[model samples]
Target: MTGSELKKLLEDSPEECHKLLMKEYGRYVYAIVYNKLRCCGSREDVEECFSDIFAEIFIDFEYREAYKGDIKNYIGTVSKHKAIDFCRRLNTVKGRSVYTEEEDIRQLASDFNVDERVDSSELRRILLDKIDELGEPDSTILIQKFYYDMSSNEIAKNVSMTASSVRSRCSRAMEKLRVKLAAAGITR
Candidate 1:
């Protein structure tokens, strides 16, 4: 049915709208949710995400107001977002493989005797301290983005920022780290 028809049905009889919504979009929403969660979630997780997507469609104002286009687009958008949320929650709650790309910044070669050469361990400590100084979400964003190789969207979910904002923060954080590392005799 058209979004206008659905909106009218929602106003006149919400129960019927709910029924019709389930009848029409249930499988479509489930498919989107399933595609997102298939690798990390159980059957129960998929069902819960499916239910949440419909619940969000029912309450979210944007979904209700935007009847100018096909309602299928609205339903699909809602499904995609809800599934992403589920993916973040399920993947985070489970034990993830702690694989981090080694930070590849190389320390400047020292001219001193072998016995007095700069210790790699000390440089690593300085690097970690600099990252800690960047503070909460910035540090977290950097670790998620570079260390864990997460996309900006995935990192934004964890940090509670928009994807673009996350990307910008990541850029700023990297620049700051580059300067700090340079001061510490580490260069990219």
Candidate 2:
């Protein structure tokens, strides 16, 4: 069914809507969660993430406003994020040491310029400012793909886009960053 029809169904008969949504998007959501959690999580984690996605959709989704685009996309995005969160928690519990805030700051600090005259901290600040300027999904995509070392498929899952779309956006965003850096006389 269409998004509008699903919205009406959700409003009119939530239980039936839940069933229909599950029937329609179960595999899609499973794929997203499974793909994200497969490397670091267990089968139970995947199952939990799947169930949580549906539960969140049933309990929290504002069908009319939030699902204006496509329900499948919404579900996929939710599944991806939930799986990622689960993986993070699992990693912490397993003492895997996923990148922490302190590590991020240290990494930024260590990313010094070749010219000792230019303060490394200042350059890091400028770079962050430029990245922020890229705005919204572009900045977010770039950070997730490069900084977080996420794969294109993983990034796509998080952003509710296809892998190809994420790659294209990442390429475009990198080009923009390169141009911005060049303008700032920081070309490599």
Candidate 3:
């Protein structure tokens, strides 16, 4: 399906979205998950990561910005990141590896001036500032969803909205934040 169509499908209940995504991209998802897990996760871990992607896809479908590029690419990108995350967490649980994709993404997303070409630090700083500007309940929900790692359902329960509403609110809030950041000169 086209990105728009797939996005519409994703607006359905999570179970429906999961089934649709699995039927559409299960093989591609499995391959990316397998590759990412090869160095880190066992077969079971890989399978769990594969399953987890569906739930994540549902979240992205409901809350995050609309996918503007190839759907497969987006799925693969998310799956690869998720696999790395799962493996890292498993390793941590086993006391094997302390390094993780979350830390790597945080660093990459940080404001390091290592390269003039990719100083996302300024953007990060502005984004955080704008989020702080949002204030109170909205800020709390946004942080819980993004920083504190709460799910939409959990966020909805706390904020007293349906999961879908939580997703839409998060998207609009992010768009507002992005606009504020861009206005503050955070391009690309």
Candidate 4:
């Protein structure tokens, strides 16, 4: 369905609009969530995230519609934020140090900047290979989010979900990925 059609659906009955969203835009939403949270979760987790994304859209229908702009872009942006938030929450609950203070950032820069002459092409290839090991939807999502930098809201509207959902899923996905990367000895 076209954006205009989806917009009309949003204006119509809530049930109708939701159904349309599920039928039409589910893939885009799934892709976005998968991209963000795939590394940190199982297939079940990805599915749950996808469902939540849609549910958020349904619940906050009015709030979403109020934002003016390209629906696809909005959805992608929102989903990315939601995914990031999820990762932060998960890290907090797990008692993991996800984001360090500025001191840590400075330390990283100091330590890694010395090797600025190193080639990144190999690292990029390896990362892509690792991402390819994920399941169908998650793999697609990760590539889009990390490799392509597509926003969650943009992905959401493409898939028909709430922007918030996209953000949370992306967060969870990234967390999972960090764990995987660490396990693979790709630490910072």
Candidate 5:
């Protein structure tokens, strides 16, 4: 609803207007308050800020007269300001920041890049290709021993080799795979 519609409702019955406003903007108020207070305040702090916003709206005659925008915008503005006030009260350091140097601004800017997304399917395909490149018994030994969680004795029996050979092959195969992955830019 617009501010005018709410104003008209307020004239008829204050109680009804209150209920209608709550029904219309409860979640909207919660979202605005939560967005501001989530980092610095508790859930009760957010709830308190939410209630304070509505109370201010109901009591402030000047706000009712002066605000001419959509009800959501007014509620949003009230909730955001209330939440910020709540934060300032709760955390002394959060609401005030002094960027003394250009380096401090650069530090904040360095953290602003968009996240790089990885393609899992292509990565998996590359992994499988690299595993294939490690020929025969070494590949078989690595898969069964690592992927299948088989003991060296069991892998030795399966691959027709001694347990010591299976153990050595598994170690050497892992180093080779590590080197291959590093070369492909998939580093530790």
Candidate 6:
């Protein structure tokens, strides 16, 4: 459905809008939650996160201002953020260290000076498109390794590859991504 139609439904009949929104975005929301929490959380946790996302968007009425842009994109952004938040809370409740050494290293690596000429959102879109172009296991490995902060062994278990193989493929994928990003003029 179009953004205008959805917005009108939201304003006119919130209950029906809520149902339609869930029907449309449920899988997308679940995917984001699963990717973020698969390593540390159960299926129930993902479901809870998905429900929380819908509750935050619909019941809290945050989507009122989101009608200007693509509703799916807005929902995806909210899903990602909510899933990350759920992961953090899960770690805290489990008494695990939320911040790890790998996370520190990743943060240090990402602390490069921002280019004033490139808008952050635009750069992010470019990078995401580039990553998608990488295809299959490479894209999945990079996301799991960097974004989700999964170790090679953990990733290996999930992907059904050896730990050493996961590391090797991850290294290769990083090089490929670096080249792709450089070609796109998104240098670090």
Q: Please, what is the whole-model Cα lDDT of each candidate in the order they appear?
A: 0.79, 0.80, 0.75, 0.67, 0.77, 0.80
Indicate which candidate wins on TM-score. 6
Query: Mind giving the per-residue lDDT tens digits that candidate 3 earns over 1-188?
Result: 76676666666565666677786787567767776777777778878898898778877777876665568878878888888888889888888944468879788779655776555656655666788787655665787687646799999898788999888888888887788777887756
Better of 1 and 5 by TM-score: 5
Candidate 5: global Cα-lDDT? Answer: 0.77
| Residues forming the 10-long window of minimal summed lDDT in candidate 4 | 113-122
- Show the lowest summed lDDT stretch of 10 residues, model 3: 117-126
What lDDT tens digits, residue by residue, belong to model 1 across residues 95-156?
56455444422222333346444566477558767987898788778866764567999999
TM-score of each model, paired residue for residue: 0.50, 0.49, 0.45, 0.47, 0.51, 0.52
Residue 63, candidate 5: Cα error in Å is: 6.5
Each candidate's number of clashing pairs is 0, 0, 1, 37, 0, 0
Q: Give the TM-score of candidate 6.
A: 0.52
Better of 3 and 4 by TM-score: 4
Considering only N, C-alpha and C atoms within 3 Å, which residue pairs clash in candidate 5?
Answer: none
Runs with alpha carbons beyond 4 Å of true place in candidate 5: 61-63, 67-69, 93-102, 110-188
**lDDT string, candidate 2, 33-73, tens digits:** 87788889887888888898889887866434655556676
Candidate 4 C-alpha RMSD relative to the actual structure: 13.4
**Tens-digit lDDT track for model 5 on 1-188?**
77777777788887888898887777557667876887788778888998998899788732448745676766777788888888888787555554468888888788765442246646765776787689878877876675546799999998899999999988999899999999999975
Assess the local accuracy of residue 175 in candidate 1 as a C-alpha lDDT between 0 and 100: 92
Instruction: Tell me each candidate's RMSD, in Å, in order.
Output: 18.7, 11.5, 18.2, 13.4, 19.7, 8.8
Residue 25 accuracy (lDDT) in model 3: 83
